[model samples]
Structures are given as structure tokens and as C-alpha cells.
Target: MSDICVIIAAYNAEATIAQAVTSALAEAEVAEVVVVDDASSDATAEAALAASDGSGRLIVERQAQNGGPSAARNRAVALSQAPRIAILDADDFFLPGRFARLDPDLDLAADNIVFVTPEHAARLDPTNLPAAPREVEMLDAERFALGNLAQGVHRGELGFLKPVMSRAFLTRHGLRYDERMWLGEDFDLYMRMLLLGARFGLTRAVGYAAVQRGASLSGRHRTADLAALEACCRAHLEMPASPATQEAMRRHLRQVQAKLLLRQFLDRKAEAGLGAALGFALAPPARFLPIAKGVARDKIAALRPPAPPRAERFLLPV
Candidate 1:
């Protein structure tokens, strides 16, 4: 079987599909590249086909109907023949030596690799990037709970949103993307995989280039999306938390909820404002207080400046 199968989900990504496919094909370890077009109305399929030309390894599939990305990805993974599978959005491209950089242990076994992008790249900025240097390591149940809890709290930074996974592990755990969740599906799947005792490999290398654009799913904010994130948080919390982990989970959930609330309040859209307010009002009273406190702390943190030397601080006191 092929060492790795790269799956790309496309929907009106004509502008970048070729580059993405070409990059995937460039990876020496990637045995095949599969592009699933979710019934795009644009020339995405055509572009993918053109990119695949002369590369007999490229397989282009089209959905009969316009399903969302999660569904499209599921369809592509089901058809993938490789032992390991890497997922990339149509608008994203992998850097050279991506597969070569992955942990050899993971490369040979049924493990997952979490590849992180560079710091200044607009697509996946380092400030919001997850822990890096894709190395495989075992995780205990408690560790998994805490790790996922921390990830939920810092979802924007953990960047566990999406990563390369082993098809064998997925099959063993029956792990698949939730077709119902359009937003944060990657988070959901990753959390579930962790709960299933999947090992992790972290890499600082920017193997993938994620294009930041207005039409991206993450670019759009909706009440349903926040609700989905909250639901994902709740799911992670229910995964048998230890006492310490439980407290951590609660704190993380409160912070996440508060951030969502703030986002809702600041949203210019009237409907989103109403929804955010309603969501905040419906949250548990105990949690609301913590959420508010967390919000205030975050605001203060944002306002604070960097620390200076003691002597300099006295000499140039602000």
C-alpha cells in the first residue's frame, strides 16, 4: 500500500486547487493525492484535473450533490488506499519536505502527526499555532483529558483543528468527520481521536500553507457555529475527567464560553448579537460569573505591556 494518501476537499477553490494538489504530489512519501470536489459551481474540478495531468497518482472525485467539506472529506478518506492519510483544505498548500519531516515512528505506525505552520505566515500565524515539531508520544487517559481540555480553551492557539492521521487508527476507532458540523469539525474529530488513545506527533515545520480568505468557513461567524464549538467543549468535558482535570475543564469551558460571548457582543450583525446575548443569558449562573471574570482578565492581559528590568523600570517608570 502507499505510504500516505493526501486528501483535499474543494468547494469553489479554483484559484488555489492546482497549487495545493501539486504540493501534495511533490511529497515523496505521498503515494497518492486525492481531490474531492464537492460539486463546485466554479472551475475547481477542472483545475484539479489539470494539476493531476501526467501525475498518474492523482485521483479526482466529484460529489453527485453539493455536500459540505466534512462530507466531502469523509468520501475521499473512504476511497483512500494509503496506510496514512493527510488532509488539506483546497486553498492550502504543503511546503516541501512535509512528509520527510514527520516523525519516523508515526510514519511507520498507526499514529497522528500535528504539523504546525510558521510564525509570520498570514494563513496560520504562530501566535495561534499549536505546540510544534511533530514528534510522536504516548498519552495517558488523564493526560489526554487535560491536553484536550487545554486545547479546547485555546482552540485558536492549539491549532489541533486539523492534522495528518493514520487511516488504521481511524478505522480501528471508527473515527469520521461529523457531517452535521460544518464549523469546528476538525476540532471535534481531533478530540475524539485523542479520547480513543491516539498518540500525537508535533512539528514546527510549516508543511501546509493555509490560505486566509473571506469565504473560508472560519471567516464567517454564526450563532450555530458558536453553538457547535460549545457542544464540542461539552463533549470533551464528558469524557471522564479526573478531579484536577475536571476543574481545568470547567475553567477552560468558562473561558471559551466567555470568548464566544465577547465575539457575539462585538459582532456587527444584529441577529448574531441577539443570539450571543441569548446564549450568554441561557448559560449557567455559576459559569457566567467565571466567564465574566475570565473575560475581564483577558482584557487586562491584552492591555498590559511587556515587562522591563528592575533598574530600567524605576528609571523609566510608565
Candidate 2:
């Protein structure tokens, strides 16, 4: 059996920390569960510790200052001694038998995720989850980059996946989460690994439940974060890849740049005035469409009734 250490990076997650810690400890294949409280003002570290089973399998580390999720996760990885590493977000958790579904041979393995609200997650029965046929897909750098492309308001992009990775592989390649990035950090790390010849496998097994909350931290990204993501995407273009992969990188970079511009335009408008923002937005005619299109999309989306939250299990077909 492969011993896996689950790393959780938390920030003000006291209300949900215990559940995340408990669920990780429930899996027999999980040798350790490490929760790094990223300088949360709340009782997050205490809550994580209280969830320990007293078997010395849970370790809660508190950051001296808030360093974002990437830094916290990198710290957890360094502290953990397990052969395999899996990331479980403070707001998300694994279902039973999740570790058993992992492919030990692959450098990275991801499983299908079921999106649930907190209310729906609380009602889930681990032993009686909806049955889904298992399927496996091997992912290369090209496939991963292309899959991460966001199409208007789509819910499940490959970028959202959480995967288990081989610690040895990470150490051998000297790879860690880019501490500079909080947005799309997972996608950036995974793409870099794949480029380095890491074997990434995705299985259609429903063993992870990702809680979709009412107000998501992802929903509110600062302009700096978007700019960082755009820079990261640009860096990937310099790596050696097939033509298809290069094209995908170009497309993804363009998307990130567009989002960054839109964010900057909005920020300037808020800080300065509409005249200043319009001047920046329309100076380059090419920039106007992406910003205008994004604004129009959001406006239209707001007019429509919000989609009812899923009351039942809805496993994403990865």
C-alpha cells in the first residue's frame, strides 16, 4: 500500500477545518493528514487539532503569517515524510476509498470530483455513493493545457482538479507550487510537471467531493493575482513543446491576458473614473472587445435566474 500524506492549506477555515481533517484521517491508506493554518485569525489550528484521532496521524502546523495557499501547501509538503502527497483543500474533502483508487505507478493521479454544496455534502453517505463506471485517461502537457481553457461560465475545467503526486518525483525535479501564485497555482504546477515528463493519469472514480460554497474565494481575485497568472502562462510558452502544445499555450496565454486586462480596466474605473478606464480600455481597439465582452457576459448572466444548486451527487466526467 502506498502511504499518502494529505496536505490542507487553510485560511480562516475554522468552521470547516474539522470536517476536512476528519475525512482525510478516515482513509486507511492515508498515513498522515497535515493541515497548515495560514495565519488564520480564527481558531483554525485548534479546530484541526481537535479533529485528530489521537493516533498521531494528524499534524497541524500554523503559519506565523498569512502566505496564501501555495506557500502553506509547500510548507506542508516539506514537513510531510510520506512517499505520496495529496492535496485536500480546507473547504474540500475526500470520500471513502479515495486513496485506494490512486495509481501508485503514475507520478500524478487525479480522480473525478463530485461537486456538492455544504448541505449536500453533509447528507452524503460514504458507503452508498452513486455508482459510476470507472474510466482512466492519461494526460500529457498538451491535453492539460488545452483542457484548462475556460469557456464562458463553465463550472468544471481541468484546472480545478486536485491530484495525488509522487513525493520522490517532485523532489527529483525540484518542483514545488509557485508561491507567487494563488490563482491557478494547481494548474501551473501540474502543467510544469507534465512538461518534465511526469505521468499524469485521471480516473473516473467518484472519491472526492469539492464543496461549492455560496461565496467562493476564487470568485474574488485581485488584479495582482490575475496579472501573476498571465505572467505564469507567458513563461510556459518558452518551454520546449510540440506545435499543438505551443498553440495551446498561446491560446491559454491570450485568455489569461484578456482576463488580466479586464480586471485592470475595472480596477482603474473604480479607483479613477469611467473616463480614465475608458481611455485605457479603448486606447487599443483590440482590448475593448475582451473587456466589453466580459462585462456584457456578466451583465447577461446577472439577469438570468441563478441555477439551483445541485441537491444530488453530480460527479464531473474528467
Candidate 3:
């Protein structure tokens, strides 16, 4: 088997599963591509199966019943034999040289596995762009979570939650994506990985490109997404973290609650929602104070001026 297995959990993804599978198979480091059809009502399974080369490099199977993305991904992992795992959405495909540049065979060094970051292609959502570029970034799970506080919102899905990790790291910690969650599942899983002592090193290699479709899950389930974010924040608050990290989670909780309440107010002018949003605004959540200080400390050593602005890449499907 190759060093890595790409686990793609798909549901009713007939139009895109083929691209996802084919691109995965093109990667030399990939042992195989496992596309788990989550009981898709359409021909997603057939499309995924058709994408297979019949050379035993791709496996397309369907769940007996519809399970969410987390369950589907876990199922694929259980069936995968490679030590490292990477997730690809059915609508997305890997970029050329994704795994080769990541150098999966390198010694784990002080970390667990080599993490490759993706540069999102702007097929539909142009606002989604890469944050880090031109360098391989590294951080512990807690530090990464705290660093995210600068964004002032729960952004678990912006490539933070998706990283190529060794299967052993997850198995050792009994880690799995949240099956019960409808939103922010990525954030919850990545946060939990940090809480369980995962040290990550990241690369800015446009590893994969996921196409955004009309009325995606985030667009369809706004309310549920907010609830999941709040739930995720609450769950993280109960875990062990530094005071700064804990406070950041608390701030994120308030932001989620505020957003949830405002959305409800807009839908139906509820007094409770208005009151809750006001309550969150009045309280101090300690936003990025500690992280900012650390950043300032690091900047003091930089003698060179900031880099000049460069053109950003935005890929669209033909």
C-alpha cells in the first residue's frame, strides 16, 4: 500500500464524484481512493464506481443507510489500509503534486504527520482563499486554536479541520468526527485533535480543490450550523486548555449565540433573541489579547519589511 489513503465521503454526488476519484488515483503517494457513498438516493455510487480504474486502486461502496459525513468518513478510514489519511469532498479533486510535495515518507520528527493545506478554487465562492502561502507553517493544536481567535468567529472549515494525518494518531486518541453534529463538525474534530495532544505542521501547497455547488449544506442549514457552532464551543470550553485558549472558545460561543439570535430575530422578531444578542455585546470575552501579544513579540525580531502584495489565485471549473 502507498503511504496515504484518500477518503472521500459522498452523498448524491454523481456530477462530481468521478472527478474526485480520478484525481485521487492520479496521485502517486495515494495507496487507494475510497469513496463511501452515504446511501445517496441518486447514482452517486455508480458514478464513483465508474471512476474506478478496475485496477484495484479505487473502491466505491455504499452505506446500507444514510449516515452523515462523519460516519461515512469513519467508515472509509476503517476500510483504508494506509497509515496516513486525507479527506476529499466528492465535488473536489486533488491538485497535481499534492502528496509528492508533502513528502509523507519523511520522519514524523517532532510531530505526528505531514499536513498539507489546500488552496480553495473559486468555482463558486470567490471569497474563500488561502490564508498561508509560500511556506510550511507549524503549530500545536492549542496554539492553532488560539491563533484562530483573531478571525473573531468559529472558522473550523477554512482548511483548518482538513489535514492529512496518520491514522495512528486518531486511533491512539479514539478520535472520530462528530456524527451527531449537523454543522461545524470540522471545527469540533480539529479542536478535539488539539485537545488530545496533536502537534501539527502545515504546508501551503494547494493540495486539493473543492468546487462549491449551489445551495450547499452551509447555505441550506444556517440555523443548524449556528447551533452546532455553539454546541462545539460549549463542548470545547469543558475541555482542558490554556486560560487564553479557553477564553477564546468562550468568545466564540458568545459570537455564535449572538449570530444565532440575530438570525432568529430577522426571521421572526423575538424579544429573547434581541435580548441575547445585546447581552453578548455587553460582555467582554477577551478577544485575542494573549495571541496578539505573542505575535507582537515575534514581529520585534523581523528586521525586513513586509512582503509586497501579489496577485491571488482563483481557479474556476471549465
Candidate 4:
């Protein structure tokens, strides 16, 4: 068994799966690499097999039916016997000598390493806007939590927790991606792991290259995706949390979901017409007033500073 098992979930990724698998195999700490093909219409499995060069170290499993990436991931993880597991999208690649940079003693450390793209670039948004990469040092649990909150508030990005995790820690906490969620399943898993008291470690080295293509998962948007995100937020609120922490999480979720909804509304407005988009957008909010109120109230409450003028209530136009 390898010290680490790298799992890649592929669907119609023939053009990129080979490079991704090769990168995983090149990882010094990765003893085994598994590729799960989710009934791809393309020759993704064939490409992965060819990349493995008949090496038994690489295993490919083709699902009989079409399952989502989360299901593929769960299947891959179940087949692996490694103590550590890292997931890379089929289009993404790992940096050279990346696994060598990971500390062997990391046991749920809260210091997730900074991610650098394949071009040695950093992105501030999921859209892959270029930015300078900063080295993140080790941080205590509370500090890391605060960092997550800060990032969520300022950058609209959640910085705590990641998909790459210790298998032992995952099993211990029964952490798994929500297969039902078509989008934001990773976020849900990450947040739950954090709530479960998982530790993290940070490395300045960029271990993985996240492929930023127009067709990538994060690039696509749909009404189902929006619904999934809202459901995730509701689930987070249902999780056991202190009043302050719950309020912060709820605020972050609402803002993020609102942003997504607004984006979709604008997109539809651009394509069809503003009238149609407004009707579409307003329908959900109208039917879900109580839910929207809870989210909006939490968001507004969290924005207030230690002391503020009473008139500051009007500052939030949400």
C-alpha cells in the first residue's frame, strides 16, 4: 500500500486525464493512483489506462451507470488502502515533487498549503483571476478558523479545509462528500470536517495545478447548482454551532448564495430579457421569504462592528 492514494474522477476527460494521471504517478509519496470514470461518453478510461503504461500501480474503475463526481470519488476512496488520500480533478495536474513537500506527521493540521496553478499563477477567485501567491505559515486552529471567516467575508472565498485529507481522519469522523449535491459538495464536506475538529497543515509549495477551463465544474452554473448551494447553507445552519459562529457561517452562506443568484439572474437577463430574469429570480425569494429573511438577518447582524451608529442599519442594502 502506498502512503498516499491519489484519486481522480473523470467524465469525458480524454484530452486531459493522461496528464493528470501521470502527475499523480509522479508524486513521490503517492504509492497508488486510482482513476474512476463516471460512465464517460469519451475514452477517458482508455486514456488513463494508456497513461498508466500497463503499470498495475494505476487502477481504473468504470462505473456501469452515470454517477456524479462525488460518487466516483467515494468509489475510488473505497478501493484504495492508503492512509492518506488526495483528490485531483481529471483535468488538473500535480506539481513536480509535490508530495515530497507534505509533512508525514500531519494529522488534521489546519494549515492548508497555498495552491499555485500549473502556470505558477495564483487566483483570487474561482474564475482564476491572476494574483500573487503568498506563503501561508502554520496556524493554530482558532487562527485558521478566523482566517476562513475573514476570507469568506472579504474575498468571498472560504479558505479553511480542503478535499485533500487524511484517510484515517475521514474514517474517524465519517466524512464523505454529499453525492446528492451536484455542486458545492466539496464545500459541504470541508465545512463538516472543520466542524469535526480536523487539524490542517500548510505548505508554501503548490502541490496541485487546478485546471481553469470554461467547461470545468466551477465554470458551469445552473438552477440546480443554486438550489444545492442554498441547501448546503441550510444544512450548515442546522449543524451544531455557537450563536456567534452559526451567525457568521449563515451570513457567509447567504452572501455567497445571493451572489450566485444575482449572477444567474444577470445571465438570464442578458440572454433572454430583464423581465423574464426578474420573474425567475423573484419567484424563489417570494416563496421562501422566511428562509431569505433568516439568511439576510444573519448577514446583516454579522456585518455590524463592535460599535456602530443606529443609522448604520441602512448601510446594508440587501
Where does candidate 1 have its weakest 10-residue lDDT segment? 309-318
What C-alpha lDDT, on a 0 to 100 scale, does residue 55 get in candidate 4? 55
Cα lDDT, model 4, residue 310: 22
Off by over 4 Å in 1: 107-156, 160-162, 259-318
In angstroms, give how far residue 249 of model 1 lies from its true place: 3.5
lDDT of 2 at 234: 85
Instruction: Write one digit per residue (lDDT tens) for candidate 1, span 1-318.
Output: 248888999998898899889888878888888899999899999999999748588998988898777899999998888888888788767766666766544512212222222222324333443334455445433443445444312133333334568888888878888887766677567667765666665534445555544466765657567666777777777886567656755665665576566555445235556566546544655445655565587689789895431211000001
Q: Any idea what lDDT model 4 has? A: 0.65
Encode model 3's per-residue lDDT on 1-318: one tens digit a residue.
367888999988887788789888888788878989999999999988888877687887799998788789889988888888888878767666667656453212111111222232323232334433535555554565554443523222232335677678788888888787766676677778777767565555455554544535644656666677777778888888888777767776675665565454344425456555444433454423433343354467476686532223322111
Flag the better candidate by lDDT, 2 or 4.
Answer: 2
Give the C-alpha miss distance for residue 197 in model 2, angstroms: 0.9
**What does each candidate score in C-alpha RMSD?**
8.1, 1.5, 9.4, 9.9
Candidate achieving the largest TM-score: 2
Candidates by lDDT, descending order: 2, 4, 1, 3
Model 3, position 281: C-alpha lDDT score: 37
Worst 10 residues of 3 by lDDT: 107-116
In model 2, the runs with Cα more than 4 Å from the true position are 312-315
Return the lDDT, model 4, position 292: 45
Residue-level error in angstroms, candidate 4, position 258: 1.1
lDDT of model 4 at position 125: 31
Per-model TM-score versus the true fold: 0.71, 0.96, 0.72, 0.71
Global lDDT for candidate 3? Answer: 0.64
